[model samples]
Target: MEKTFTEEQRNFKELAIEFARRELNPGSRERERRGEFSEAGWQKCAAFGIPGITMPQEYGGLGLDTMTCIATMEGLGYACRDSGLIFSLNSHIWTCESPINKFGSESQKRKYLPGLISGSLKGGHAMTEPDAGSDAFSMRCRAEKKGSHYVLNGSKTFITNAPIADLLLVFAVTDKGKGFAGVSAFIVERGFPGFSTGSALEMMGLKTCPLGEVFLQDCEVPEENRLGQEGAGAAIFNSEMEWERSCLFAAHLGAMEKILESCIAYARERRQFGKAIGKNQSVSHKIADMKVRIELSRLMLHKVAGLKGAGKRAPLESAMAKLFISESYVQIATDALQIHGAYGYSAEYEFERNLRDAIAGKIYSGTSEIQRNIIATFLGL
Candidate 1:
């Protein structure tokens, strides 16, 4: 489906593509292989206003609309091969930056948003705990209120950008008796006393994204640092997820298009049995299926964007988009690998890396199974 984007949106996409080609495309594979986080790349992206795409200009952001942001991200995915970097950026903006923008007080925003938007300060979300993976709300961490400050004692695992994060949006239980509602969100700075990051954890893909544990050993945060009202952590978290699940896959959608182009180019150029592989029906059909998936995923993503821009609740649409786009990415990667035959299996080619990275999409944001459950529940199951 062809989208009718405004001239400004189109311009944003072009700018994003040019930026990705110049900045992110080169050395992406090497960085992924070495598990090296690109501080330079982050700075470049910040200069390009990527971290502040959806933020208001008053707080050092571009303040682009949802559709423009989606278009720009899609362009970035199309031109950039650094899936890890893209994932890290999304986690920072959606999970960390958005919460602070929406819930932070005037002083908090003044203190953090500028640095965050300028890439001088990297942020992370700390919600997932060792015991809470799919059940993120079942965390055992506690924040005890004492006079003017809250003493936090907990450890969060699988935290993206933990090792390099300057600021973290952490959630802890303030009153366990209230279950999910008992949780609260706080802006914890890196140098806060008793706040520390654990060693980075190795992962299948997004290796350079720096997943790790954030430990709070009686970490004290002023009452003013609380993100929202007391016991509003779960609500804030869910709201952030709604935005995250809807748009986090924007880059992956572009990646699917990139893989499709690569597969098609390979099929037409590679000789097999005295003829190009594109001459073979099997090879041609795989390419066709990849195109189909890319188009379908794009349509779903566009629908989600439209819903969000219109201020409508898109829990169902976002879940469907996330599940479909993630699974489609994995399929496209697999097909691209198969099209490359033996070469695809080798680390020398980018197809294998794409496959490895694609696999993570199915698990993060929300697992495919979890998305399915959400869809089923929404359908009155």
Candidate 2:
């Protein structure tokens, strides 16, 4: 499919590029060294209308169309080097903000959407447990409906914004025997009784985004806090995932473009033996591969975004985009590192961090293996 941006998209992309450069890139390397999440950078993004791009205007959002959002995100990735912060923002935008906007009752939206979109209330969904990685429906978190409230008991690990989150969208089993149908979703306050967050776990990369555990032991949530209806967690999760897979990796695509551009620039400048490195087939071929991956990744990402912009569900397309872009990102990152030679191996160089961040794309949202399974099942496997 041929993709062309309209005037609005072009404007949004320009705005995003400027915003990321001015607001998000400063102090990024230092923050990354300390593994710190930048609160100021997050608010800067909020002021730029990033966290709320897809939400309605009344809720402090830009209310941009999906492709425009994607385009702006690509711009953000291209200009910003803080991949972890971008990842955190993406998690909040898609997994938390979009679902609440789509499935939330008006009161829920009025209560939560504005704070979240404004970046005053950072949060993310809690679905993955120690045991429920790929088998999400096998969640052991139990919620017992007791009069006007539900009592929750379980622990969720590897949550993206757990330590800093003021709120959390939690999934639990409301009916033990119904399997997936038993699952239910709820919004829990950080201070709610029995709700606690663990220390941020250090990771191989994307350390600027806090990752930790959410523990809910005998936590009571008012019935009013439940998302959608009773036993609707599965549907809500799938709904979130479809949007997440389709759009969340947009920044990574932007990173790939940036990496490709940087490598090309380097190839033209660095002299190997006698001529520029771009002269060698070994060096030039990697750059060529990077170009192909970026082109294909952009096309696929755009296709899924266009589908979503039309209000159609795109699980299969989203899976393909997620699978392709993520794997391609790692490949491009690897190649970028190779092209940078020894410099890529040093912390002083951006390529080292780029490769580290790209490796994570394969694991989150759904692993590459899981994406293939979803694609296979969609193809009548």
Candidate 3:
């Protein structure tokens, strides 16, 4: 199906593609080798108006609609090979900025939105704990009210940008006797007393975007820093995951497209036996299947984007999109690698890193298993 885009949206896509290639593409391999986060590239993107894509224009954001935001993100993934940088940027935009822009009060927005939009402050959400990866509502971190402030305790693990984040949205139980409804969100700053960060914990892929543990030992968060209603933490967390499920995989889509193109080129040029490898039925079928997978993923993603643009609740669509796209991305990457043979397994090629990164996609933002459970409930199955 053909979809129309506004002239402005088209311009946004072009700018994102060009800027990502020219600015975010430099030294990606070397930076990943050193396990470096692209702080400089992050600033460049913020200056380029990425952090504010879905924010209100008054708050120093571009105020782009959901579709435009999706298009720009997909463009960035297409042009930028620094998967870690892309991951960091997406988490910032969708998880942290989007929620604050929607739920933060005028005063709260005034205090944090500008700096976040301006790239002066980095932000990430902390919902998962040591025992609560997929079961977010079961988090053990707690926050207790103490007169003028809330005292936060417990720790969060595998928090993105944790090592260098200036701001964090920590979700903890305020009244555990009430279960899920007792959960609440607090905005904790780096310099806050009793708030500490641990050393970075590395992974197989996305080394450029650092992850670490956050510790809060009676950390006092100001009353004003509480996001939304005290018991609405689960709501906020669910909404953030909904947005992440719908939009976070736009990068994966772009990466899959790139992999498809690379596989085609490799098959066309790499001779097997007497002729180009693409002439073989196996190679051609893989390329065709890759194309099919990309189109399917694109359609599913666009469906979620369109619903979100119309200010619709798309929890079902979001779950389905994330489930299909994340799984398809792994398959597409595998097929691309299979088509490339030894070259795909070699570290010199970007395909290997993409495969590693794609594995994490199935695990994060509601794992594939969790997605299935959500979808099953939606179907009354």
Candidate 4:
């Protein structure tokens, strides 16, 4: 992988690591404790061009390839301890910015992409309603056309960046008779009538990023804001999911790399019965397993990223990758906590927080079960 990277990617990765360590890591524990969103960190990341890694240069993006994006994000994960901020950044780029870039009309792209990529605007999507998580297409949100506007009604929960987002990619049922095909997506501005965000919901992890509900009660959206065609929401959603599942997990690979290193250092330095605890088979084997998981995770991430970079749809490969990497992260986090014993459980070290954050990876993007189902369907099972 090192040999395969372009010189630009290598340089970008190194710089991203340095930038994140210097700018994003400070006060992370305090932000996490307060469940505060880092506006300053967000701007710093924007100024550093983290949000525009794969966007077109014309639209204020880096115009880099998918591999470069993943490599840079992996570096971000390795150096940045603030997982919530990273999560929010990924949601902004993959769900909000990427979908608009791919499916929006030229006018819409010109209107939204620059601000989104430039970091002046924060964006997230409202797809998971209270009843429509894994079954996202079953959304109860409805958008009815009325002259020059569409009136939207329904609520979306567990929305990332909701509390602070300037724009949102909202999906709704435009024609219930057509089922999933009836779904449509719309770009909703924060100032739109009847569109409001709920108070932030506390979570076990990723607390530094705001999460909340989006309520659309007769929210009036301009016709020009509709993304793609009238019934293209399902396709738009699937595309975003593919990109997200393929790319967002790169951060996890970086994180696992960090966790592995910490575990090794602790195992080597901590004394036990005779010498370093690393000499014990139990402790040493766990650290060895961490390395194994990280390498395998890296291979899977690279494979999916390669497929995406080649302009291919990799539903099967991406599902396999998401399932493996997410589950592997949880296991790695568990082993890391175990390796540190009492210290790991304590908040003084980040192991407990890392575990909390890792658990969410399994639930988001699609649960481990959902990924298995996707892979099974691909197998014609």
Clashes counted in candidate 1 amount to 0
Give each model a TM-score: 0.97, 0.98, 0.97, 0.98
CA lDDT for candidate 1: 0.88
Q: TM-score of model 4 relative to the true fold?
A: 0.98
lDDT of 2 by residue, 1-381 (tens): 114788888788778888888888989999999999999999988888888888899988888799888888888888888889999998888888888999999999999999999999998999999999998888889999899999999999999999999988999999889888899899999989999999999999998999999999999899999999988999999989888887778888888888988999999999978999999999999999988988988888888888888998889999999999999999988888888889988888888898888888899899999999999999899
lDDT of 4 by residue, 1-381 (tens): 355568888787789899999999999998899999999999999999988989999999999899999988888988898999999999999999999999989999999999999899999999999999999988899999999999999999999999999999999999999998999999999999999999999999999989999999999999999999999999998889889987889999888988988998999999988799999999999888888888888888888899888988988888888999899889989999998989999999988988999999999889999999999998899
Better of 1 and 4 by TM-score: 4
Which scores higher on lDDT, 1 or 3? 1
Provide the overall lDDT of each model, using Cα atoms, as 2-decimal numbers.
0.88, 0.90, 0.87, 0.92
Error of 3 at 10 (Å): 3.2
Q: What digit string (tens of lDDT, one per residue) describes model 3 on residues 268-344?
A: 99997999999999889989988888898889898888888898888999999999999988888788788878989
Backbone N/Cα/C clashes per model? 0, 0, 0, 0
Residue 56 deviation, candidate 3, in Å?
Answer: 0.8
- Please state the error at residue 181 of candidate 3 in Å: 0.8
